[model samples]
Target: MPHTNPASPILQLRGAQVAYGQIQAVKGVDLDLFAGELVSLIGANGAGKTTTLNAIAGTLQLSGGSMSYGGDSIAGLPAHKRLRAGIALVPEGRGIFTRLTVEENLRMGAYTRKDKAEIEADMQRVYELLPRVKERLQQVAGTLSGGEQQMVAIGRALLSRPKLLLLDEPSMGLAPLIVEKIFEVIHTVMKQGVTVLLVEQNANLALGYSNRAYVMDGGKITISGSGQELLHDPKVREAYLGEIA
Candidate 1:
């Protein structure tokens, strides 16, 4: 991992809260993402991990609290503004335009940017990271397998040239081998200077690859530690890791 400045976080959330009608999904969630670090949010269904990401991406508004990026307040920014500010989100479902070719989908990701040459270069870089995507670049996105679609989603997010990448359930519903490949690509993305905030159901994989992790339940963060520490903690092992502590 690259040296991250602890004093300055790339993304910061203080007492963040999100609600839907009568139910609160994320309550007073305080989180930080430092530059060049892979941070994870691990939790069960309805744990609010996805909600947190949505709030940060500006798709969902925070009922209370504040969010800042690089010391500037982003609380009122819309989703497009946030994307323009270098925050890109690969949502849970691998949202790609099914009818579009892989290349078309990738091109859409760079819509917010004006540098055509840089965008093409970034697309090539993504192809290097995911060769399978390159092989299927001219194919329709819907014709690809689930794993390939996931790659397209990630590749699209990369094309945005984001400072912080929010990945929700990148490994969900994929085979073990495909998941491994995705994780490998994620590490590569981090090494290339994009900070990642991952929300995943696979606690073992998340804890293994992340520098730090947070456990959320009941709409709030309940535990946090270094990845290794959480991997070995009795409570974490029992609850998230499927180990009978």
Candidate 2:
């Protein structure tokens, strides 16, 4: 079930904007992510999807508007601070350290944590969740296939034990079967109580997996609805689903 807590939102952004000098990538966006719900933000290239996620992840500063997490303003918090506050981002292109072993990369995820025993336990849990990761613990991250690298990236993020997981393009550049496996792992994570904000180009898959979704165009959100509603919407079908009608 989707998170029904009416008292507070896990993450909220109002009038959120980001500009790179004269180029405004994300312009005056308003969004809310509730606990225990999988939300997708979908759009074509240059539609500001990545910019919005970067703002939420604290990698980019917002030029306008307010952002809050768990009802407290976190506008000035650094990226590491946000991680400590239970927000973890699995960035696009699987940004794992190519030189590091899978085990070493996973350990990097818990760098901010001081609980040795708990971190160890979490590592074991991740291994169980992704058996392929466990089998290649000593392998260099760069040596793995695209799908394996993705698995390691996700497992590393899970070690942080985040309340909200920001996934940017997990399905990019993978074979169809690989994409399905990645989505399956994501679904498992969601069921395990991680609120996910997924940014995907695969509209059909994103809408199918998410509870609710937002459509972006020209740096602004143009549509918002339940996943099923958007999936069947005529405009969405034409623009995102590649329907001729």
Candidate 3:
């Protein structure tokens, strides 16, 4: 059986807006990511999907409203400070350090931690989850295949031992097989008790993995519902689910 909770949200964005220069990429979106749930965000290319993730990660300031994590307002916190507050971002485009070795990238993820022993333990656990990363620990990131690079990116994020993991387009530019593998790894991570906020252009995969999903378009969220519910909605079928009939 699936899990259910009536508790407060672990992460909440209330009436948030994200702007770029003169363009408002995200307009007044409200969302809650509960503990032990995977919340997927899906939309078209320019629909502000990445912008919302950026806002939540503190890369982009909210033009309005507030963001809270675990009941503490994080609206004013910087990106690094948010990480220390237990938020980790596996950014879009698989933003790994191409020139650095895989082990070096993993070590960089632990930069904010002062507890050396715990960091080491988490690193080992990350390797256990991604044995492929362990094999390429000393290999330079630039030399790894695209799928391997994705693994490294996710492993690096997990090394931080964050309470909330933000994944933006984690399935982008990968083969179908690799995409399935990545989703499986995400499930494994969630099973270990981390909350997830997933943003993906591949709506089917995102909705399938998430317990609940939010659908965005033209800088606003137009719909929100259970993953399976959205998957079967007629409007969603015509729009994101890719059904013409």
State each model's CA lDDT, in order.
Answer: 0.92, 0.92, 0.90
Against the true structure, what is each candidate's TM-score?
0.97, 0.97, 0.97
* Colliding residue pairs in candidate 1: none
Q: How well is each residue in 1-245 modelled by candidate 2, as lDDT tens digits?
A: 23355767789999999999999999999899989889999989999999999888899889999999999998988899999999999999989899999999999999889999999999999988899999999999999999999999999999889999999999999999989989989999999999999999999999999888999999899999888889999999999998988
- Clash totals for all candidate models: 0, 0, 0
lDDT of 3: 0.90
Model 3: ten consecutive residues of lowest lDDT: 1-10
| Shift of residue 56 alpha carbon in model 1, Å | 0.5
| Cand. 3 TM to true fold | 0.97
Prediction 2 global C-alpha lDDT: 0.92
Runs off by more than 4 Å, candidate 2: 1-5
Task: Report the lDDT tens digits of candidate 3 across residue range 1-245.
Answer: 23457899999888899888898888889898889998899888899989999888988889988999999989878999999889999999989999999999999889888999999899889888889999999999999998899999999988788999999999999999999999999988988899999998889888888888999999888999988888888888889878896
> Can you write out model 1's per-residue Cα lDDT over 1-245, one digit (the tens) per residue?
32446588989999999999889999999998889899999999999999999999999989999999999999979999999999999999899899999999999999988998998899889888999999999999999999999999999999999999999999989999999999999988988889999999999998899988999999999998888888889999999888875
